[model samples]
Target: MAFERNTQETYYESIIRQGYSRRDFMKFSTYIAAYMGLETSAIGQVAKSLETTHRIPVIWEHYQECTCCSESFIRSDHPIVADIILDKISLDYTLTLMAASGHQAEAAKHATMEKYKGEYILCVEGSVPMGDDGNYCCIAGRSAKDLLIEAAEGAKAIIAWGSCACNGCVQAAYPNPTQATPIDKIIKNKPIIKVPGCPPIGEVMAGIIVHLITFDRLPELDNIGRPKAFYAKRVHDSCYRRPYYDAGLFAETFDDQNAKEGYCLYKVGCKGPMTYNSCGTIRWNNGVSFPIQSGHGCIGCSEEDFWDNGPFYERMTGLAGFGIESSADTIGKVAAGVLAGGLAAHAIAANISKRKELRDSIRTARENEKKFES
Candidate 1:
């Protein structure tokens, strides 16, 4: 019943006509629900959302970026990302993958803008160069700024993909000549979800898209416009070597026994404590591995100004430690000392507590025997 959509095809009827079965649609909905951190009861909402809501047309604009966001998106562990999102979710214009290009492709994008008019979703990758009155980057003889505003005017929402689009990444670093600017700095009127990373986690990218498709709304964003569900905690909170961190064990340097034994990378400049992301859990390369798991410290790619955060190989110094939250410096020694103290205390306290219970039971038994003797 959702109108002759922008594409002139209704939501449910369009996918069916495109060769997707109802079962495929249901599976995609369920998967998206989980990715969006929805409850089991919400799958119904998710299903209805997809079934009733027309696929939001996306105008994927690329500028001063390497297109790694799209690469990571398509390589997600889940097929739904590439299959449903990239191939099916109404991506009308993209420079890298679109078969149409030159004057024809530009015309198609213009047609969608006029036809959809405040209905399509705008996804921007890379930063816009603003120096020299935005003349640094141009498309089809129009400044990037002009193109962005033109496309955004017709968009229902905007998604800023990767640090390039969110924070300008390395392009906006100090002494920038072109004055690279993030999307948020230019687009102030609409809601923007910033998924920042060198290349965002593939599944996380998929999750964001799916949340939009399944809920027709943005996911719960944190102060930074990142989804709280995925960026809620530091990677340190979930690292496997966290026990080593708490116990104060460190590798000191790479190739040491501790490093080989999978000790915490805190000593090797891991930014896990300061970085918030799903890198430790969702991982990368089809969930096969992440930097930390591969024995490298987190570079905090998801964070702002990470390029200036410090040298990636230099560990953080002078952190607070208490309540078993010690760093990698003294964990082994402290754990040994604590174990020794507990062992001595447990030995002395064990027999007396057991004997007191035994004494009470024997007294009760003796009284019962006296009663029987009488």
Candidate 2:
């Protein structure tokens, strides 16, 4: 019994120690399981894992990024997610959240790496600069590349937390000065899950970790290494304005009547058609609203190299299936223009036919009068 007492605490035990009831723990498990896209049957499995498995060691490393991933993560709507996953978990090292710094922080990282080698998860939140012998970015007098290589050497898997880590983001945009490179590029041997966005949604981030914790394995990934559960459907599939797009109705401009009436924003440079993210379904700021819901286009922040995709206000031109030289704006406008022209032509023809009938009747009346006079 003393040996059992010395055993590592499971996730449920940790939370319960923090004053959460068993009912609350079960509810929290069910909630996170749903977020992980697990069915009702799997909720029991998730709860069991949380109740039995010890906390996995996590090493969160920062490179060249805005720390928005951490910012977004801490704002998760689920208290259990923020507390259990982010706060109470065995997160041995993180530049942003850790209390220690300098020598103490480096020692903690090394200790965890040594103790949990090949068992810990390494979460990278930014790009690694290789230019100038990696002089562009440094931490504790070591190049970003050296730190990444050392950390990734013993990690069981790696999770790239944002666009900066997954696809180099704006730092790797055209004419990259620092030669910022994504995690996948720098570390190729290990399994890497890329949760890409300018900053991905908070719940989605939690769901990925919950999936890892519950299943003790990685979630099914897409070709680009993102979780299929969240990135499977394009934002266009679940967009509220999809029917308008199908019917060819679109806002011609941002301030137009169609825009005010909640028409599709495809014409106004919305990237929902090409962007694969859960923003439309999951929303943001605790489901308050996403960019599209807030009257702005998606800007395709989740896609790779979105910074170089061209002007945000100008829609993509020359789409293969669109049949127009420009984007949805041109197609919608051209279709509307054609419809208006057809209506005008039809009205003119109808009036012409009516006038001819009137003239024929008048002639017939005049002829009948002449016949009667004769």
| lDDT against the true structure, each candidate | 0.81, 0.87
Q: What would the per-residue lDDT of candidate 1 be over residues 1-374, giving only the tens digit for each residue?
A: 11222554545566676677888777866776776677889888877866777677778999889999999988887665576567554678888777678887887788778878888889999999999988988989988888998988888999999999999889887667799999999999999999888898888888887788766788899987888878888888977778999998888798899999888888889998988888877789977888988999989888887776656877744333432345445666788899999999998788676998888899999999989954
Tell me, what's the RMSD of every candidate?
13.8, 10.4
Please give the clash total of every predicted structure, in order: 4, 0
C-alpha positional error of residue 247 in candidate 2 after TM-score superposition, expressed in Å: 1.8
Clashes of 1: 4
Clashes of 2: 0
lDDT of 2 by residue, 149-261 (tens): 99999999999999999999999997889999999998989999999988999999999998898889999999989999999999999898889999999988999999998
Best by TM-score: 2
The 10 consecutive residues of candidate 2 with the worst lDDT sum are: 1-10
